[model samples]
Target: MDPWVSLDPPMPAGARARAGEPGGARELVTGALADGTKRGDVGGHLELAAALGAVVPRPASGSTATLWESLATLGAHDLQLARAVEPHLDALAILDEAGVAVAAGPGATWGVFAAEGPGVRLVARPDGERWLLEGTKPWCSLASHLSHALVTAWVDDRTRGLFALDLRDPAVRTGEHAERWVPRGLPDVVSTPIEVEGAAVTPVGAPGWYLERDGFAWGGIGVAAVWYGGAVGLARRLAQPVGRELDQVAHLHLGAVDQHLTASRAVLAEAAAVVDSGGVTGSAAAALATRVRSVVVASAEGVLAACEHALGPGPQVGDASYAAALADLRLYLRQHHAERDLAALGRQAEHEGPWWTTRSAT
Candidate 1:
């Protein structure tokens, strides 16, 4: 995979050999989270990455090199789970549990698994102290290999629940969703739909992890990173061979995206810092974080649009590569989270700290 060629780089080598050291997509995510945990409370993974690199920085370790290659894991679903592990998580980077019970439980081990849509349903009930789950989930990004899945289920049909189910058990069936498997965006991204009937599960923590709590909104990071990567690829593809328009737009496009990326970094850093220091659970800093993401996504869209104009009609239209990336990214743009997440940012804006608050003095 050539980032210049396909806006995606080739997958790294030797998963079998690297089995113990930061191997697989989940490990990569775990490594990244571990890195962020060392730094602060950031949730937007890329921003956390940037903050790690640009702000606090990660400990120099060989594992990080693998972590860098693991970035490609997000793109893995496009190539099936095995090929998708590296530098990106098959582009399924966004993972948010509606509640703590869902986000932080045992099945949270499968937090690396990105569901097809954010509309993942979880069904949890009390069977003594342990909870049991039964429901269908589509778009389990790494479901092929993911042994656990963190989900938000319904409680008593009135409220919802979050559960972490161990997919390792034969009782918990794991396979691609035969009924519906194709997604308009991220094709080859086998977000396998899942159906768990009476699957043995466990409760992660309490109810706080599963709800639309503070940290829930922090999920924009991975999605933003993948989309950003796609935008970079598109813009790179459209980069003018020697033209006035595409070439000029490329510089402007990068500049605009840089501002958003920078601000987003700052916001995420603050959010992470707040969480790290125990200043807030999640929402204390989500407003600015979401705002930064909004800008980043908007600028990324501009980059895509400029790519279209730069490459001209015939090339982009005729080329299979452009069509593929465009289709996938376009679908992401339409998802419930993209727009709704921004709406979330807007809704929370009123309650943010002084940094994001309206200035009456001005």
Candidate 2:
């Protein structure tokens, strides 16, 4: 059997180095990104964000969604920037803990640190005397930077294992992410596609060490919050113009839009509270994730509809800033969690026959 796994206590700690980070730096950087950065081309900057999140306080327990939220919000770009660094801590720390390699590159982007194929997933394999890695990855947030990748690939039969690869080595092909559907919101993100060519990697620990099992819940939080932030930004800009003269229909539509947005954000805050409370990986959590992703999508659409109704004329045509902001929000609205990730809860919850029957048999 292959020997690798997600961390029992997924994710790690000791990341809090960003406070000394440039004051308002996150705001400034995202502001610049609002208009200049093209959609799907900021791989370089996203790596920095992932690096920042990775360097700061990681979660004490892997299950806690707070850590993921913190990392995602370390800045608008953090999710993509400092994501890879999460896995390499042990890859390097184990060596340090064991008095071996003192230097290791941070695997800031976790997605890039993985490999997957057909039946098997994650890191684990027993190829004679060595394990072999093979698979393709998507949305490797820190693809552009970092020294190593923690990847998951097909192991034996249908099982998977998580493995770490030192990117500095010649066997591994580490580079940039490919063209993706989602863009604009995380322009600096360099999530790319990569291949491992008979790469030499070591098993850091055991099988299924966990790279955030409740990951959907965590992803939901960040995407929801970003929507809230974007709404706030859009509202702040619209407040003045909103007060201007408007048709009765437009006024009512605007008011309704505002109320919808406000309610959506309140729900988002509640979702955050749930994550903070450690309800991030259950039936309720999955349901909540679906709800939040849906709400954010609706909110973004409403905001645009309101804007178009109110300013779709000369003002909007002339104001490039307003148009650009709307475009950015639209990119994130395409937020998608594959059906496989969504169905995870049900798959695990199922009993061979029926739960009642199984219990009776027992």
Candidate 3:
């Protein structure tokens, strides 16, 4: 199946240049925001994500091949630019977390609410046969723009559940979001805290539905793919022709960067095939995500360092698009979780077994 079907079409001239600007990601879909309007070609971004079945990830509707394809495209373009897009993808992950899928309107957008830090404690209260969610949910990306969200909340002392929340509800408060989301990289991404009092919500699945499924790790690898793409984008700068003035040191740096990227790409390709074949959930998928994310993160960091050292400040200070990509990639790769993720990887390796195993000739 052709994974790029939706995204392969020509985009508006200079749209990408604009996308590198602050809060400019909205232009990816440009006129699609207007009600009842269909923007030429641009309208296909989401539809292609849906059609590729990567971000949505279900046997009945999506595929890993599609997901990787989309991630590579988005990552290479601008990692930060995808911030405006990933929340919608994450919304799908949340519903899939609950083993539920609901048809949404063409322009509908969704956000994920799983930030476990100081914020609102969402509690589910019984409202006759229905459920009401009360309290605040933090790290709600695109809260101001989304029509709905799949929120995680405490159903009781022992259970957590996934809820489909309509953002348009009068009980939902998104007014204070803008003041809270000031970040250097994805500053335009409005990941804010939202308070909902007595807001009605539909439970997508039974309790503990969001994290127990295979999609959890699958979604993680998708994020890694974005990072990988960003790394590729940075590496592309080094791929250009350097005049004879280029030194052996610069040539050596470029070669090392290429090796890292090539290795990481092979790992990513293998992991995608593993996920597509199934059975890569629970600890197994987690291991895969950590390994892939680590490799990609390392590659991106190494490439960034090598490029900065060899090319110096030319691209970063003078080239607007290149500078944005470099800055965005530096920030986006922080999703790696550093030591915490490395600990998880170590544990997985210990549990899996000895790395070197010799077998008798068949």
TM-score of candidate 2 to 2 decimals? 0.58
Two-way TM-score contest, 2 vs 3, winner: 3
Which candidate should be chosen as best, given lDDT against the real structure? 3
What's the TM-score of each model vs. the native?
Answer: 0.60, 0.58, 0.79
> Least accurate stretch of 10 residues (summed lDDT) in model 1?
53-62
lDDT score at residue 178, model 1, on the 0-100 scale: 45
Please write out the lDDT profile of model 2 over residues 1-362, one tens digit for every residue: 11111112223585442232233333433443443443333455445444444443322233333333333332223323222223332233333322333234343332334434354233345677767665555445455555565565656665555566665666655554355534554455446555556766665444543343454354555556555555545654555574466677667767867776666656665665566567555555666666666666567678767776766576656666566566666665565444544455346445421233535445
For each of the candidates, give the backbone clash count. Answer: 50, 54, 2
Q: Global lDDT of each model? A: 0.46, 0.49, 0.67
lDDT of 3 by residue, 206-269 (tens): 7886777667777777777777777777776776734435579988989989888776777776
At residue 362, give the lDDT of candidate 3: 50
lDDT of 1 by residue, 86-153 (tens): 21221122122222232333212243432435666656778887777777665565465554556556
Clashes of 2: 54
lDDT of 1: 0.46
